[model samples]
Target chain A: MSNTLTPVLSGRADSPRLAWVLKRPELGVGGLAVVAMVVIGSINPAFWDAANLFSLLRANVITGILALGVMIVMLSGGIDVSFPAFAIAAMYLTIKGMIALGYDGVVLPFAVATMIGLLLGLINGLFVYGLRMIPLIVTLGTGTAVRGLLLGAVGSSQINIDRMPPALIGFGRLEFLRSVGGGNGLSTMVVLYAALAVMVHLMLRHTLIGRSIFALGGSEEAARRAGFNVRTTIFFIYGMAGALAGCTGLLHGSMIWVANPRDMVGIELDVIAAVVLGGTSIFGGRGSVMGTMLGVFTLVLLTNSLIIMHIDTTWQRIVTGSIVILAAAATSWRDRRIAA
Target chain B: MTATPARRMLALRPRRVDPALVQMAALAVVVFILMASLNPQRFLRPYVFDSITYMAPELGLLSIAMMLTMLSGGIDLSVIGLANLAGILAGLFFHATAGASGPDLRHAGAAVLCGGIGIAVTAGIVGGAINGLLITRARVTPILATIGSGQIFTGIALVLTGGPAIVGFPGAWSAIGNGRVLGVAAPLVIFIVIAGTIGGLLTRTPFGLSLKLIGTNTRAATFSGLRTGRTVLLSYILSGTLAATAGILLSARTNAAKSDYGISYLLQAVLIAVLGGTNPAGGRGSVWGVTLALFALMLLSSGLQLMRFSNFLVDFIWGAFLLLSIALNALRQRRR
Candidate 1:
């Protein structure tokens, strides 16, 4: 058995054909997601229903946005463990500021919220890139500070969006394909998610900044030697992530009708899980927006199915966590095989 | 008086006492001054020592676990989860055997002693094993793996209790958690013992040396045939065990267990570890430094509570301190 395996292993190592088959790791995750969907749908009839499917996509948007930010940071060879807290903080401050300023109108709130998010992200980037500190520790600190700021800003009362302007409420309530016979099939938020995904895909694959991010992730020193403004790029990446997280927070506020400091506490776990499950390497330098989208979808679908099945929320968390571990393990196995 | 080659080598080796320790000491001084200014009478009260002694044990255990993992160049974010789980498990074990209504005086003493130490140690070791398996054999990054496992562990705890607090443990168990020995809390004593033992292991044993080498340079460790994978695995296991033990102590003290029991400890553990001068990038840290950091943090927190500061203010201050520490560490490393 050893002799036979040795010949096969050596032959494969020498062959480009075998290498091509071995190199792609994301395919395994994609395949597992498909299998999981089929098996789950088969076991639970409601899993394939349109209403459940739409909610899965809708629920996934927030995670999708956060994961997108995480992907960029990871692509730049950094990790942001503070996004959940930052997202909640950004959301709280944006809504509070708007309310205090009496800019209850739609355009102003959106603009201000985005700007606030951008500013917050810039701080993260500055501390991480400019100060040359570890991204994890810096963001963790900033994340706590931001959460505290939100608590102080909002006090004990949660800002209820129900009293907001009708137009803002409509934006929150906006759904796509509702008039068509699909039973409120899609949402504007879902459309935004898709658009963002497309834009990110292009930026990562086509643009010079995207290439630079990939180069940085691949090797920071090499990229620096290659004339890439590594610090500037890092700042941009982290800032972009923060801005996106802020936008997601706004979306969350609109969707949930409240911006509480405690809401979404420790949610970075979910975002990171989605990124990892989508087959992105934690070591950074390689990822796909499409894969992340799928990852988000898988988690959302799983959660929805558990709810539909009336499984307890606690069990749901366990299942979701197990899935993340399984996904990570699968990715690692694939990487090892490729390396071997 | 020419410097010998040995002396030069010793000088070149990373300082036995990290410069971060100096910053921490400075931070401690600043904190003391701030506390004094805020409320001199309360700050000087002997009762504050009691508070520190009470909080030290669990914090110490948590800091040691965190320090061990950080030294091996990984972070275990799942300690809180593991601790919560262990606490719940201990509660259930006590409740089942001793009755859930009140203190089972007949069995309470043994249960408290055996259950507290036994369940804690087992949970700690097992949790560490899982982390080790995932990180080593499965080749998952420590942060992601631990975070995922943490969720799973917390979920299990939640499931066990149906998302409610598990209470009605024997009084004797509580006594051990709340009891003092030699003018200090038992928990503080436990912390000292564990920290001292682990510290000795980390600094004295071949295993400890290997861990430091692995954390500093994995490829170099591997090339030296140090079994880098096993070393990482062991560190993670040790971390898991320590976290679990902390959880048990927490449950015993509170006389109840909840899924959220260890949640608040997560950030605190990391903060204490780093504040104690453990490099975030892994390798080069000490139990002694972390122990001092634990006391400093406990003092600061207790001081804030006495001052009627809002939880938000406390959080903000802590976050500021964490950021400042990291920034200072970065600067010092750059200078080196």
Candidate 2:
């Protein structure tokens, strides 16, 4: 009865083409995203317009970057909820530092922000490795503490668009594929996202450290036995994640031309949902860059195009939550099949 | 080496002290002293105690709910979302039934009050069932499932309320939040009764034993023929129910229901539950421990507030306290 009820779970790939598609790993999410785009586009022709497509891409760029960082951590069998806080702190402090020094250069500011993020990530890595507590709890505590301290002892005020560094704003304005009819061209952020995604994909596929991350996530003790220096890998993943988050935060602020301390609140769930939807296992030791990028695209389209499709904006959360559940269920079913 | 003073002292004491009790007592004394030294007149007043009694119950209930799931090797991140949704639904019930003047349940009669409670509790049960099914049947990871469910709950609340708070609960309902029983605050009384009842259930019931066994070792529990799935489901249902109770208290106290009410309470609940000695990895926790931890945090927060500390600083302290307590617990486990 249950087998009949769950056809997707019970059915095996009957054809060579179907089996090949399934084995590629990335095709599943990529195909789902294409289908979603077509459906949404058909429902609302406006969704296919260059402006709307650009807006969708804009919304995804920051979250996509953050999700990449989270994907790396998840790949290493750890959960991090602290990146948002670190990102904001790094962005805000970098701006404040620039203002205080009366300096307005893009390169130095981004470098400083990345360094700050790396430092915060190292702290999380320290606690997770040293205290040997669960990553979720450790990150939760650190995230809260970092946010609170930033608001309390540091500054709670927002850096408005006018007060933003001109150089950084100019950097954000650099774009390509300038559309006709006065439409805003795609920002340089898309290029950055693509480059970063490709870089992460290559690193994960080619590097020894990347393999160590997978091994650590698969089984910590086993990784240790294999002489992978599990501690270094743990530190490396978190630090890398933090650095990316920090850079993305500043990128977000520059694009929007403001740094609000409260921005990025409650984004952990959305990014995590997207990553897992992309086929990254919450239990770790599985996932891919292509899958995660496609997953983010699907999520961004669904959320951004709700208005165009005549759905209530509030329904976005419901749909996203359902996606998370369905994705996790699919992952669980697949894991069981492999085990069997 | 055998005749050392420390060894002799250890030999002299047959029973070890409960760390939860010690932590609770030490926290109380420290907070009391600190507050007294800072502002003796203001801190020692009945008004301050009254305020703390009123504020702690909702958070206290949520912490207990969090503890229950943790004890079963799971967690309920949906507590806050479930809580707000429950409150909003109950408020909507009263809003729809009450004549154009708005719901003033004080004179609306006993049946109306019962209806509100019933609505909230049923929502809790339904929400908990969803979480349970996702975890046990769908086999989604507990955290991921709860996170998703929490989002759904909050979204529903947002859709229902249209981003604004639902006001006008029955006056009688507010009385439950604000009224006193023999000079004690009503919320405190309710908290005590529920806490005591849960404490009894955990110690005296088969379900409780099975939950702990499952947490401690799932394979062993299955070998022993324990109903692991049912126990996990009950844990979530009970967690949801407790969260609903907190929701009722929140609406009654504030006289309104919103989608984002008590959002910060989620973190605090997790922190308090863990500080109360509920292991994050599961298999061990006590109602008494959680109760003590609740009081300790309440007093500590109250003391900090009395000192005119900013809310941000308070949040920082709570996070620090959680980290410190976890570190201490880890060290203690290492020693064992």
TM-score of chain B of each: 0.92, 0.93
Per-candidate clashes come to: 2, 2
Candidate 1 lDDT by residue in tens digits, B87-156: 8888787767767775373357764568656876797788889989998888888877888899998898
The reply for model 1, stretches above 4 Å from the true place, is A1-26, A179-185, B1-18, B103-112
lDDT of each: 0.78, 0.86
DockQ of each: 0.69, 0.69
Mind giving the per-residue lDDT tens digits that candidate 2 earns over B129-185? 999989999999888899999999999999998899987778888998898999999
TM-score of 1: 0.93
Docking class of 1: medium
C-alpha lDDT of candidate 1 relative to the true structure: 0.78
Best by TM-score: 2
How far residue A106's Cα lies from its native spot in candidate 1, in Å, is 2.9
User: lDDT per residue, candidate 1, A51-142, as tens digits?
Assistant: 76777778888889889999899878788977777777766776767667666656667666677777888888888876777787788888
| Leading candidate by lDDT | 2
Q: Over the full model, what C-alpha lDDT does candidate 2 score relative to the true structure?
A: 0.86
* Sliding window of 10 residues with minimal summed lDDT for model 2 chain A: A1-10
Q: Model 1 clash tally?
A: 2
TM-score of chain A of 1: 0.89
